[model samples]
Target: MSSTRTGLLLVCLAGVLWGTGGLALEILRDHSPLSVLMVSAYRMLVAALALLVASVVLRRGPRLLALVRAYPGRSVAVGLGTAAYQALYFGSVTTAGVTVATVVSLGLAPVLLAVVDLVRARHRTVTRGTLRLALVLGAALSGLVLVSAASGSGAAVGTRPVVGLLLAVACGCVYAATTALGSTVLTSADADPLALTTVATTAGAVGLVPVALVGGGPFVTSDPVALGTLGYLGLFTMALAYGLFYTGLRTTRSGAAVVATLLEPVTAAVAAAVVLGERLGLAGVIGSVLILTAVAGLDEPGA
Candidate 1:
């Protein structure tokens, strides 16, 4: 397969993996006394440790260190950005419903990124192709609204929606900025493919140290379910997910990359239906189609 296609597939899979995060984190919180910040701290710490082990096993530690030393600013920005956006997202999930939080934060990112893409290609902004791309984004966003509406049935739906919406918007903006910049710096020909993620996650884990101390929760869980959930979150959603995202960014446009990850909310909605016994009514079905269609539309040359 073409590298671009490979990148898209990898990013989409990352989105799917990320979709499970909110639910898993929520479950962990219920069983443990971990605060949002604490959980985020654990997440980054675990992801960093896992990547460190991978680097040791692969023997790329020295090269990655060189990359970090070579571009300290980029490394630190991406790392802190990762932690900030995640903590903000978790906060949004707490105040707003998960479905709503997911929709707002993830949905806003693609729109912001598309704007950047258009500016970068200003000469093409008035073309017919550009109009079609706009329509596709509109459809996808509309579908997301439907999905969000369909996904809200749990106790966490709306304790403080306004606060959640604000937090989510902040998360989206931070994430969009990170993706735009990260795509440029996270992939390098000489550095290990995992270099950027490893560095960023390690920094992020360190950045969250104060959070871990302030939030105060046991890192050691006796419950197997909580332990497994933590592993899934740290490994699948974070370490592996980000590795795939940046790798995909090597070939995919930032705008298309974020949009492809729109699958996240849909995946979350489905997980809700299956695990939480929530209903996916007609709106959910229609929204899913629209999102999938929009993602496919982006593959066209003009888009």
Candidate 2:
């Protein structure tokens, strides 16, 4: 198979794995959101350990460590941003409904990142095509609003308070900023994607420790289902999915990679429908289509 096709396949698989975490999270809803956050934190720590071991075994230790040492500042910043994103996102969902938090956070992230990119491009002139891409992204933002409105009646829609919704938006902005900064730093360093992921995950896991502490009680695994859910999320969603995504990007064209990652929201939506029995109204369906269309329109041909 062609490298591009292989890359696309990897990305799709990554999305599937990533999507599975929501199901896991649903299964673990018995626990407090903070407890769940702790589970996620531990998962990151485990993933980092696993990746570190793998790197050594594969004789990539020097390279991985070198990358970590070289970009210590950028790596830590990205990792902290990632950790903050998770904390705020969980808090949002806890206070607000999942629908509200998810829409506000995930939907706004790309828009913010695109704006950042545009601002950076001001040092250089943006082409007409880039401007068109911006417009398409704007449409995607509109679609997110429509989707949120359509799905607003669900329990997860207003579960959290207004403050939670605001926090979720803040989470989105932080996530966007970290992602943009990470991309720039990684590109500049020619960092190994897996190694980069390992560093960021380590940083995020460390950052979560204090939050988990304050919100903490003894770690209790009273239920087998909860344990299983946590396992799935930590291993598959947080670790493996990210690994596949970065590796896939190495092979895929940049445009194709972005398009593939855009599948994340669609995957989440479908998972919600199937696992949570959350029905998407006609408006929601229309909004989903619009989002896909907008993403496709924004992806530059040679990106």
Candidate 3:
């Protein structure tokens, strides 16, 4: 298979892994004492620790350090932004229903990236294809809104719609910026994706120290199920998924990779239906289809 295809597959797999994270969070809510902020911190801490151990075992410590030293500001910015977005996303989930939070936050990322593309292309002649791509973005966002609406009807848990929307928007912006910054790391000479991911997680963990501590309490939990779930989140969702995502960036366009992650919400919806017995009504089905189509469309040669 082509490298591009491999990259897209890796990214799509990352998205699928990400979809399961919500379920893990739910488990934590039921069994763990960690607050949302603390959960984010622990995610970073565990992922960083896992990566560190792997680096030592694989004899890549020197290379990881080199990657960090080469792009200190960029690495820190990406990691810090990543942690900030996670905190904001969980905050939004509290204020906005999960559907609204996930859809809006993830939906806005591609739109923002497309806007950046348009700005960069302002000097060039506009083509019909570019216009079509813009329309695709609009459709994808529309699908997200539909999904959010369906979610409200089916299982609305949010109490503050306005606040949640704002937070979700903020999360999207941060997510977009962080993703863009992370792509830069791949462009650097002798870039190592594994090293970059290790550095990113480490930096994110350190960056969240103050905020996690401020949230306080609920930091320690003795429940084995909760502990195992937490480990799954860090190891699979953050570490493995992010590792694949960065590796994919080596071959995939950043914008396309972002769009490919639409699979995340779709995967989440399906998983909820199966695992949580959440019913995805007709509207949800339609929305998921639209999103899937949009995701596939973004992979067209020029797109």
Candidate 4:
């Protein structure tokens, strides 16, 4: 496969791992007393530790340290961005319905990144290709709204309605910013993707420590299943998924990268149907197809 195809596959694989992570989180929630914040903290902490160990074993510890020293601000920004998106996403889901939160965050993020790219281009003007890309993204987002709204079973909306929209938008912005900054750090600092992932994830873990402690300590549970799921999330979802994501970002545009990751929600929807025995309604099926089509369209040259 070509380098571009390799990048696309890496991103798609990351999305799939993320879907499994969502499933693991749902299972953990049902099986334990851990709150979402606690699970997030544990996932980050464990993933960070695992990546740190890997870096040392692979003899990338010095490189990691060099990146940290050279791009301290970028490292902090990436970590904070990760924490911000996660917190904001949860807040949006709580404040709005899951359907609204999912659609708004997932749909807006790629658009935001695309806009950022347009703004950053010094000489490249928005051309026919940009317009076409916009239309594809719009179609995908509409389908996402249909799928997400119809998939839910009438959850209660929070009293403060506008807060949810704001949170979701913020989540999208943070996602875009972090993605662009992450790519910059990777290229400018010539950092190892896995080591950078460790640093950024560790920062996120540290940021969430306060919330995790206040929410409740002992994030780990005695249940074997829950422990196993947590390990999967840390090792596979965070460590492996983010590593691939960063690696792909080396060869992919940030906007295109976000578009590729839209597969994450699609994967989750399919996993829910197959693993949890939930049925995908007609809209859900159509929505999944539209998203896949949009991602596929992105594979064309110059897309």
Candidate 5:
């Protein structure tokens, strides 16, 4: 198979792995004392630790440290964004159903990125494509409003639907910011994606430690299920999925990779419906469709 096709498959696998994240968090909420913030912290910590161990085993410790020293500011920014993304996303899932949280957070990021790019390129001549982009943004916003305003009987336990939607939007914004910032570092001639990810993940864990301490109580859990779930989250969702995504990006067009990542929300929605019994109302479903459509449309070939 062509490298591009292999990259597509890898990205799709990453998305599917990400789709399971919300459900896993939900399971932890039921079986463990860890709050959303604590879960986020632990996930980052474990992933970072795993990466560190691997770097040592592969004799890349010096190279990883050099990368961190070379791009301190970018590394910190990426870490902050990563922490914000995880905290907001997990909070959304805790308050909203998996379907809503996944759709809003994952769906909004690409549109946000496209808008940022357009603003940055304001000096360029406006064209029909620019107008189309505006239309897509409008549709996305309208959909967001619909989803946020939706009220029905299908909400998850303790669902604060509106708040959840807002958190999801915030998650998307953070995700977009981090992606843009990380891209700048990743595109450098001598960039090592794995080392970069390790630094960011480790920094994120350190940054969130205080929040987890202050906001989350009974942080230690002896539940085997919870412990295992957290391990799965760190190892599979954050570490493995991120590794696959960066590796795939080496061979795939950025736009194509973005489109392939849309599988995340689709898989999340299906899993929520089948495994978690979280149903979406008509308005919520419509909003999800609009958001996904806009995000996909905003992704251009070379993006």
Candidate 6:
């Protein structure tokens, strides 16, 4: 396969892995949502450690260290955004139902990001293709609304009502900004890929430590299944997924990259139906198709 095709494959794989988080967490529903948060924290921690070990084993420690030193500030900023996004996302899932929270959070992120991109494009005129992509995004969000209506379940996930929604929106915003910032940092630093992953993951883990502390220790399950799931999250979803996403972004346009990442929700919906045996009503199914179509439209050349 050509390089672009290979990058696209990696990007889609990353989206699929990310989408699996909800289903994986569902398997551990008996645990506290805080436990989910702790698991996420630990995922980063483990991912960072694993990458560090791999770097050493591969005799790339010097290159990794050089990159870390060169881009310390950017790494810290990206880490902070990543940490906040994860915490708020887990918190949102706790406050809102998984499907509701995931839809709202992920759906709104690109909208906010598009607005930001438009503002940034003020100096440079917006292209017709961008406008078309925006329309498709709007259609996708409309589909989310329809899907949400079809579900008909209304139990709040968190203690704070409005605050939870606000936090979830904030999480979306942070994620959008982080994607933009991370791409810039990675390109400018000319860093060792493994080292950057390790630094960002470690930084995110460190940020989550206080939340883990406040929530109390022995944060997650000792059970083999739960531990195994968390391990997959760390090794594949958090580490490998993000690494592939960044690599893909290096070869793809930002707009196309965001649209491609929408595959996460499509994968999540399918997983929910197949693994969790959750039925999407007719409206939900229609909405899913519309959303997928819109996203595919956005991925068209020049869109």
**How does each model score on lDDT?**
0.84, 0.70, 0.83, 0.83, 0.73, 0.72
Off by over 4 Å in 4: 122-126
lDDT of 6: 0.72
Best by TM-score, which number?
4
Candidate 6, residues 102-212, lDDT tens digits: the string is: 666777777876776566556366688677867878777877766655543443545654666876788888888887777677667566656777778888888886777
Count of backbone collisions in candidate 2: 6
Minimum summed lDDT over a 10-residue window in model 2 is located at: 253-262
lDDT per residue as tens, model 4, 10-108: 988898898776778889888888888888888888898899899989999898898889998898789879987988988898888787788888888
* Superior candidate under TM-score, 1 versus 6: 1
lDDT of 5 at 137: 66
In candidate 5, position 192 carries an lDDT of: 76
Off by over 4 Å in 1: 155-161, 187-191, 218-220
lDDT of each residue in 1-303, candidate 3, tens digit only? 789888888999999999898778878889876888888788889999999898889899888888778888898888889889998898898898787787889888998888776676673766876877876787677777676666556665789989999999999999988888888788666788888898888889999977899888867888999889889999999999999999998887677788888777777778878888888788878988887887777666656
TM-score against native, each model: 0.92, 0.82, 0.93, 0.94, 0.75, 0.86
Regions of candidate 3 where Cα sits further than 4 Å from its true position? 121-123, 152-160
* Off by more than 4 A, model 6: 1-8, 30-34, 119-126, 146-159, 217-220
How does model 4 fare in lDDT?
0.83
Global lDDT of model 1: 0.84
- Could you tell me how far off, in angstroms, the CA of residue 153 lies in candidate 3 after the best superposition? 3.5
lDDT of 2 by residue, 129-191 (tens): 576766666667666766666655555444548889899999888867776666666567678
Candidate 1 contains a number of clashing pairs equal to 0
